[model samples]
Target: MLAIDETAAARAMIQISRVAKTYRTTDGEIPSLRPIDLSIADGEFVVVVGPSGCGKTTLLRMIAGLMPPSEGEIRVGDRIVTSPHSDVGIVFQSALLLPWRTVLANVMMPVEVKGLPREIYQPRAEALLKMAGLGGFETKHPWQLSGGMQQRVAICRALVHDPKILLMDEPFGALDAMTRERMNAELQRIQRETKKTALLITHSIPEAVFLADRIVVLSERPGAIAAIYTVDLPRPRQLDVLGMPEFVRLTTTIRAHFNAQLD
Candidate 1:
């Protein structure tokens, strides 16, 4: 087993050291993120929360190796990430499921694309579907499911390959309030069971406080890590905890950071 220092291990399952991102535009050069030094530990759930144009997604993309940083380095485990790898999985705001594929087919798509044997991954796919509460919906198409259900399938798809790290960008942002809350609860359960290192990007302070072991707040455009607050809340968190004074206190504190950035 990988022994990690719970206290200091925020050193990162994935590390972003002095990273920056720049884009060449028609006008000139545009910088999205500044030098950001951050670490997400093994099996740790970290949320990056910031305003609309805070470059939160840009940071996530860099970590996933979907895009390279203009400067600095990103390391996953001991390897530097320069390109997307099978060990990392990503889910965006949209479920992005194939319309024609059944839930099972979508979940198994990663394995198919990798040219892995179906027999080797079929059982794993089935178990993931069941875990995501889609056991009976395996044969159903993406259009046949509700928004929340579609997102659930998207998550199972991300986890189907047994990735050591999962990068999610506002996966529940599109759902209704109640459904989003339910999905939040389901996500906590899934994280507890899978223990995958996760990095979530969201604009919701409460969501960040509820789902993250640590919340990294970023400043506006050309984003930089403004603050990092450890949740320190007990695990397997009950949704009811959201109503507790402690939860409310933490939420307010995070909100204050965002509010300060605006000023």
Candidate 2:
């Protein structure tokens, strides 16, 4: 068993038990993800980084129950994740906002889909907008916003539903360097406030270092746990912290794995 921290005050939000995946292609069986055992403590933020096509998103899909693992089980709380559940919110690379809907309505999409009363959630939607720096843009359409702003709406939509777990699949991968950095800070602030248990997968080592409490790095294709690094940096992390020795050391360690694989 992987050693989980005993200092945690709450139960783990997600648990993976020797999980693995393989796909049957017309050509032959293809291996995707190798055995993975992980524990994400309640309200903790974890990130996964690996080479592209290394089964990073595959790991996330299995955890989210969007796709089933060929072996082993994933448990969210006491329930086995056989299918996607309401308690999980997902964000992908694309903002996926409705162009026709105003920012406010877009944020309310999940609430509406769940058949919850808008009156009860409208205030929350507004508050999320304010927190995302989109307060004044609430009435504007998605086209009026910049890439970062549109993603901010997507983040608000994810949180407006109040899901216990937030799963992100490189939600900022499309942005330029400057925008991505700003989004990272924005995400860190929002996550600190909400304290939702979050697991995100990205290819960027720096991003993984910036937002994660623990970062799990996967090996090449048929991804398996290569290493897991605990980010002991102080909370409410500022952008300037990236220049520190510890931050550089951590990123370097993770990069070494990929660098070695490429050579």
| Model 2 score (lDDT) | 0.91
TM-score of each: 0.95, 0.95
The superposed Cα distance between candidate 1 and the true structure at residue 76, in angstroms, equals 0.8
Instruction: Give one digit per residue, the lDDT tens place, for model 1 in 148-184.
Output: 9999999998998889998899999999999998999
Candidate 2 residues 1-263, lDDT tens each? 23445433227789888999998999898899998999898889999998888888988888788999999999898789998887788888999999999999999999998999888899999999999999899899999999999988998998998989989999999999999999999999998898899999888889999999999999998989999999999988899989989999999999999999999
> Which pairs of residues collide in candidate 2?
none
Ten consecutive residues with minimal summed lDDT in candidate 2? 1-10
lDDT of each: 0.89, 0.91
Question: What is the clash count for each candidate, in the order shown?
Answer: 2, 0
Model 1 residue 138 distance off true place after TM-score fit, in angstroms: 0.8
* Winning model by lDDT: 2
